[model samples]
Target: MNTYRLQQLLYEETDIEKIQKKKHNFIIDLPKYSFNYQNGLLTLNDTSFFKKNEYLFINKHNRYAACPKHCYQFIELNYMFSGKCTEKINGEKIDLKKGDILFLNAGSKHAISSLGKNDILITFLIKEKNIKVDLLSQTKGFLNISMENITPFFTDIFRDKQYHVFRNNEPLSFEQTLNNIIYEYYFPQIYSAEIIKCNLLKFFLLTARRSEKSCPDSQLEPHNSILLSQITEEINKNFKSLTLAVIAQKLNYNKNYISNFIKNQTGKTFTELINIRRVAEANKLIKHTNYSIAQISELVGFSSKTYFYSEYKKHFDHLPSHDRQYSAAEFLKV
Candidate 1:
């Protein structure tokens, strides 16, 4: 079916939604998990809802149906395809408009207000295992920490099970990617699964890039903001040989001052950021190219294979070979 047909399909209310309208309550069978939401129990949607071997589930949120407070067993991404919807996540109310996107991690307690018939919200449930930290490692505000230390960062953001809403400043590419995924999902063909995966990766990469670049210079001190812009551009372009000393000389700042400024802003030492950049680039090559591990290490500016392996493992918690094996499996999977 085409996308227009899919839209027509989504506009039609389901039997469950019809029943819900009569009862004025969402009556879906949900796990009885005890959660304190305004001193009430919150339902849990466990992994049992997913079939075995399924990594992703996509559907349109019911129109004119108010979903009850519930938490999920998997991560979720929601796109406000049209119109608007209001949702309360962990006590915070969020209003999402057309082209906006919302990301909710597993265990985020949320309740959706009733949606209008014109509202079209697309929901995607992704198994937690499907997320690759390497992709998000480049996100701003995520300090360049080793894999061992990254857990603490995750804990900070996810401890509250917070949800993030990103307004679609530029919607063409974002909406096109979402449309492509929905098309492949509703109209499956040979290699559709792989296409969905590729589109999902692109979706995440675009999100990361948007988040990284969305930070306005007005948010930072004027001098520091300009310095940060220059420093990041330098590192992104020349991470191979870029050092705090080299950056300091290029920017005409004291080496110690540059080091301290980087640490203060990102909570990561200058060396850690460079290594993280190198490892992130190497991971991209490992996943997308036929370069050998040794060649990738050298290409990313790691002088010694041993040191490269050490840094890569620290960031990914696995040898580069693991990524190669995983890529091979994905390629050969039916």
Candidate 2:
């Protein structure tokens, strides 16, 4: 295409999408990348044909391409600011919408697809040194932490720290908070390595916390939340073979207290809450993939298909087959 024609094509395409339709090969060689921040538009740098530049990844593709399979040196994160991207990672497939945060950890192989225009993403290719110490320290704020001893590596990254998120809109005040970090706070000193390390760690913490707003332990009642968390952990690890009696005995509480506790905190009786989660997983498998109804039934902790289906319909108001066949958006209509 001629330059004029290409420029004209580009001009006609406003808010173009940044994604591909085909899967990209996962490549190793992930590195720390950075972009120049200017008016909500960050530039993507190119590091290798298979890999993008250090600090950030910026690409605009309508077709699917192989991503560099998971590498050892870096971790990848992408926040969809607009449009959507269907991703296939290792073996799991996920559809990312605006406001979603996707993480590709070290050694995690993945690929992606583009939907249409307005499908922009803000990405971070975090370096290993940044991931090991700095990111952990900042994100510890999200969890219950009591760090007494400061590691030398952590001390360096903490010299100046700030956090940022992509794809979600915030009030002017919050946006200004983001601005202060990007421009004012560490301000890219001669120790660019330290400055970059700090901001990236901050971003990791901010993004991780944003996704965990419904923290079980941070609920209205701390004690109740802690109990619920233990219950949840038990169910998660053994939801398939779960028994209310077993959980009640394990917590040294009467069955009635356990039942009432779950009801008061989660607004669902013990059995009902269990079914809620079991059925929720069933719904995801049903719509997002081609798992057979019977298969999904087992996967979600149902030992008996009949019982699973019965409980599923009771809570979801639809047969598992019908609900699973449709995406969450479509299921709501029914």
Tens digit per residue, CA lDDT, model 1, 166-228: 787674358878878898988889998777766766676576556545434435788888898
The C-alpha RMSD of each candidate to the native structure, in angstroms, is 16.2, 14.2
Alpha-carbon error at 330 in model 2, in Å?
46
Query: TM-score of model 2 relative to the true fold?
Result: 0.40
Models 1 onward score TM values of 0.55, 0.40
Give one digit per residue, the lDDT tens place, for model 2 in 56-95: 3333233233342223234555656456777765344677
Q: Residue 161 deviation, candidate 2, in Å?
A: 26
- The per-model lDDT (C-alpha) reads 0.75, 0.52
Clashing residue pairs for model 1: none
lDDT of 2: 0.52
